[model samples]
Target chain A: MKTIKGIKISSGVVSGPIFNFERGKLTVPKHFIREADFDSELERFNTAIRKSKDELTQVRDLVHNHLDEDHAKIIEAQLLAVQDEEMITAVRELMVREKKNVTWAYFEVMDDYEKLLLKTFSQFFKERTADLKDIKKRVIYHLSHEKDIIQPEIIKPSIIVAEKMSPSDLMHIDHKLTLGIITRYGGVDSHAGILARAFRVPYISNINRIQEIVSYSEIILDADNETILLDITDDIKASYESRIQDFRRHRDNIISDKVANSTKDGVPYHIYLNAGFVDEVKAMDPALIQGIGLFRTEFLCIERNSIPDENVQFQAYKAVLEKMNDLPVVFRVYDFGRDKLLAMLDLEILQEDHVFDEWGGIGFLLDNPEILKAQLRAILRASAYGNTRIMLPLVMFVEEVVRTKEILETIKSELKREGLAFAENIELGAMIETSSVLEELDELAKYVDFFSIGTNDLALYLLGSGRMTDLTKNYYHPKMFRAIDKIIKAGNKAGIPVDVCGEMASDPYALIGLTAIGIRFISVSSSALAAISDEVSKIDVQQCGKLVNSILNADSAFTIYSHLKKFYHEQLE
Target chain B: MVRKEIKILNKYGLHTRPATALVTLVSKFKSDVFLEYNGVKVNAKSILGLLVLAVEPGANLIVEANGVDEQEAVDNLDRLAQQKFNLE
Candidate 1:
């Protein structure tokens, strides 16, 4: 087998057929059709278009049945482009205007708009490919864009080598057979990089036109050493043995050491797990997590379909509770406004839409009050096994808290009247995802037993930025601290326990910053639990307290963020 | 054709989804539909035509559809105005 070398982006070893998709262009065939063949060529092109359109639909169906209308337009566009009135009519106009045959006229009209069509189709394919989660999707996407001779070989073990990819492409690649990803273009901050980290696959991006260096179906890879050995032979293998030995050393170095969370003064903080899905709960290390602090119910409502049936919802909730056993597992009810989840639900049911109509309609999460009632009723039913807390997301005002509490009270009284044993005094809380909640903390805290700061959303709202789109925005920035400072002061004043559950909580460097801001409680991912606890345990709370005071007095979020980084590095060094 | 002008209020500019929704709504009527914004007028039923208008949040636009449901067309088009193009 021939071999080629490149940088390893992720670490894994596999050998499979190489599916190299070159970003290419298609245009009108060079030679014009004769008058005799015009009818036949047009028919052929129409057939090709029909076939491609059918393939797109089929491919989409394999991944998902119902697509959002916007996504549906992509397929619609492809269909429309095939017989576009403008393109067809333009060609007809050219035929009469220039005295050219139908095929030649069609070619000339298409040729002028060829670049525009390609650009449109390319973007459309990019989006559709990102949505693809399986091979059927890849094939469909490829077929949609490339109407030429289309074929898909059954390659069980496959390796994808692409110039660059979107997040959806990386998500769809069959992780089981896909050993590694080799990209000629991308960066450490690319979605591909984020995905590689998430999938635990070794991938190397930004290899400088590395595609030309390695041919399709070439044997390559040095997974552990972060190299893609090209043209490998026994001699090359023998020579790389020393490097292979280092892999063992590196693996040993990676072996994580366990540690507990205790302050310098020996005060301990709860490092709970902030899990969303049942699978994530199963993945958590029991020894590391105190319990599930905030289970985002919104994730359960992510896909475009019917609201989860009671059994489905119960199963997911039960799975997390079962794994936690006696550990406290707080189930935060779906609290996001209708924009993300229930965009199609009736507007009247959405609470936020009454105030804002930017979202097409209130999503089911916020719009449907009955959902909260139904979900709380489900949780109350499951409360027998584990310590449970029912929390809400984006708790903005006191009235919402009162409204939810009233519903819960009714559920409790009904359970009592029915003579069923349930956890009567289960804790209630809200995610401080919006800054507005901070203003209403005095009144809101009375209803909530504790608070969890979802810095992701809070920062987005505070910065007036898009939460999903703007990833570069940091919660560790000074403005976030100001918000956190407000939360800490408000929660502390109200005597309500408060914690943070954002990606920022996963950062060890932020542990001291959090504690300094009087955020003694942190809910992190299972993978981050041990490391954060270890870091938090070592921090001098008094020193953190001093930092918090300094940060609070600082002029801006950036200044406070920079100061914290300097302090963290100093401690580490 | 009777014409009425309105504004685009959705945060995200008129893209495929909103365009499709708008076009589909107008197609329900038996009227010739047209839209004008920034001095450009195009067929309301055409996606490319609608997108080319690049109607963004806070942009004023005019709608003209003349047929059997021309008044209903104006009413539905008014809903788009009231809906503010549905971007949050």
Candidate 2:
């Protein structure tokens, strides 16, 4: 019996069998040249290539129906791999000239093509087989048993430890019969990690060589602390009993409480959630949030090759609003720059393409003015049911706002002519993110109903920060506070309802200071709202106001942050 | 050659799904049907050509056909758009 230690991403425990699956890897083995079987070897190599292509098709068929668009791309990529010219050429050369066996030729070509994609690892299934017949038998078994066997009725569930799990693997695995996942291969931010988060399942990635540790039995997992308490001895069982009690206590507290955040002094404030995809929208329990803060309408408009029609948009918006019931839900109009938008629009490559242009662009919208109006018209039509506000992204000048408003008016009049009953006095807002918008805030806010300060864009734009890498570091930096101060002061003077929609709203300390800075409505992820609101209820906002006032007087952001941190520790108690 | 006019009726105008329906409809005809918007004529089968025209709702689009069954081609396309097929 052995125990393994790894990072715990999800919280749960179960004990089951060591069903050792073949891990994909790459290794070059020295084989003696046999002149007698040379003709047969070449034939075998050609047959293996044919077999590999067929297997790819089978896997694609199995997953195509069950997987989402993103997962389907992974299968498409694998199919592309099967037909790759370089791989095909290499296999042909080895078989026709080098006289290698079918399996050898396939492995050799995969090794050569390994470096092209980072995630597609090339690994030979090395087993201690005495003859070629044995290796072929194992290969057949692997292919035949690819259909995952799941028995949910089995009382004892097994923990699945793999190098990485594909989307199909996740779909097939019986969640009721499976305890958890421990991967030695994937990053915390990879697709698998995101899946685990979405499923609300406990998983840990980046655990090194987990297979060598536990013999698949007699090992216990503690997902809550990401620890594996091993050696199922008599004393360990006693300890497990005690830990179970503590686990139940923790679970009870989280499941029972559902509070939409209020100020420390019992003052009410709106805490809303931002949803991009339907899965995320469906996952949100509205009893936990005030309303949908910002439904990123761009996903529906920007994901596919062409924009979705008003009815498609209507179904998505109506479903979300219906789920929320009477709650006020806001939708941000499709924000597309030159790069993110599809130039050669097709259904397949639409989601695969990135928003990268020579002008440091992040979207595809410059040439597509009609697409923008199509989206705006859709949003206006959907606003007829429940309270819906239309917000624009990357509005830098007053002219853009005026033109957008004119477009809205045209759509509204068209709707009226059709005798469509729509939301009267629908509020229009702009995301204050661009430097140009900041400079023209006073004038721009006058035309819109409110302002949602997109600090993620604001910080990146001000510091000339990279959107992907510099987000976390720059967001927490003191310079970000100074920018917040400017935006808050502008919003306060303008009398427009302003809310922070960036990741910083999730921060416990930032939430406190934001309320202290005189900004009330804060939008964050639904998961963090209850926790942050609980923290807010414990702080003295008046004292935090004094601390903010002192911090604002400081010369630099560094001094201001340090002063606030120290004040939070000393005075909050 | 034959010409037929149809008003854009689907809430989604000549996009991918509707583009697909229109292509399938035109492919059945012996005559080649051409879609025209703002005086620019394009092959009804060309997805890229149709998208460039950017015909919204309530706009008048002209369909011209030239082939063995030109009249039949024009009649079929006109019926599809006017009836708002594949939309409901």
Candidate 3:
């Protein structure tokens, strides 16, 4: 028996046979074309291009129907690349000049372009090299008739092992026939990682030489423990089988537990789920969550070639509201920036020296008033179906709030002119993420109905560390809790309720601090609802307040974290 | 032939979408449009040629168009550059 340690991206345990899927690096076959066969080879190249384009068009339509238009845009870009006049002319010229095979000619042309792009553009544009390579792979596959690694059909339920998987590759994976994912490369913030988490699949990444070590072996993936047990003995296998049964039973018990939203001391706090996709909303248990705190609208824009029209946005928003049975849902405006760029909206990349200065949240919306108006109009229209609210992200300035409110009023008037029905009393809010907003909380609160403190960004901005990075995990900072405390106090002064919808809200240790700060509403991922609710049921609000007060008086974040850990073991555990 | 010097005003400079827009717009005219930046000249109607130039914000380029619609093409392209390729 052997055990390999890896970073656990998503938490779950499963044992199954390994389906080893390797994305073999394409080695272009270099050969001189025979003088007699030159014309036929050139014809073959043209046919291959035509076939690849047809396949891409089919893939684009399929993705559009299955996922959304945004995802379809990725393949659309590839189609355009295939039809790019300059790239095609360059390849043709290379083939004619060197008398080389089609594969080698195509590779050389793409490689030269890629190198040029990498040298000239910033990292943001340099990332497009992957897309270029993706297009290259499609054409090469057509030329060579090589089967794509991620074929739709899988014979059995097995753990998918790969050297690396791209976002597009992850989208095509058959999740039902897959037990878990073990990969040699990927960060927690990768698209594959995010999808795995959203799907509640057991995933582990950065497992060195995992493909070599566990080739088609019966593997036990304990994501909770971050261990991959390989070739286990019969005795161990029996023990794990029972353990799996126990774990499932325990999970079922948690799900079935009829727990109230209030703490043991009778302090009621609201718990909502953060959803970015329709599938997440459909999977949520209404009884477990009170409402949807954050519906990330950016997800709808990421993969599409064009900005989603009002009807498309309206349908998505309305579907979530209908599924949630009229529960209070907060729709955040399209927070496009460095990570989420809309292909249709050709907005400027606003990064100054690697720092995202003004591209996220309200800035992007304000810069493009038309896009913001479309979203506001859609959200306002959807609000007619259920209880709804609008939340703006990355609001660092009071002027931003005022500008957004003005835009909202303009959209409302336009809708009124059109004689459209919308909820009259839809509330508006802003995410308290930066210190600039925190300082002006009282003034900003006057313009909005409530505040949802985004702890992930708040913590990162406060500590000057990036999220999901080693620097963030290693550093202990209590500044975020202090920021939350200040925001809650400001909300109290303004007679508004403040909620938190960041990673901190889902964390057990952070929950203690949050409750202590008098935060009444907490929004976490749906998967974390049962566990967090279970923890909330055990917490005594008064005790949490006192403990947190002492911890706050402590020196640093490290001290507060250690104190909280000790308190958890002594009391909750 | 008509020639005019202009600077890229968009925050992200001439990236993919803007490059495509420029190429598509130039292709509409009967004129042959050529852009010269820092001694490297490329056909303005070719997306790959424009992208390879990798023009950033504040870079100065001379737009030259020659044909029956040379004046109109150069004037329209200069206007597009001034408006930051319509990507405000």
Put down candidate 2 lDDT per residue, A87-139, tens digits, no spaces.
55666677556766445565565543333222222111111111112122223
DockQ (CA atoms), all models: 0.10, 0.01, 0.23
* lDDT per residue (tens digit) for residues A1-573 in model 3: 888999887778888888776542465667888777668777777887887677667556644643355446555556666767778788888888888987789878888877877887576567556666666766775566442332434579888888766543554456667778899876665556666766667888888977565663687889889899987887888878976666545433425544357887888878887878886787666665688899888766532323567898999999988888888999999766544442222111211114334347787678767678989999999988889999999898989999998888888888999999898888999998887787798889899999998876776678766433433342236677677778988999999889988767777777776787687689877557778888888888877778767655767877877877776777788
Candidates sorted by lDDT, best first: 3, 1, 2
lDDT of each model, Cα atoms only? 0.59, 0.58, 0.74
Off by over 4 Å in 2: A1-261, A277-288, A299-307, A335-367, A464-473, A553-573, B1-88
Which candidate wins on TM-score? 3
Instruction: Order the candidates by TM-score, highest first.
Output: 3, 1, 2
What's the TM-score of each model vs. the native?
A: 0.56, 0.55, 0.70
Candidate 3 CAPRI category: incorrect
lDDT of 1 at A355: 30
Query: How far out, in Å, is residue A147 in model 1?
Result: 32
Native contact fraction, candidates in order: 0.07, 0.00, 0.27
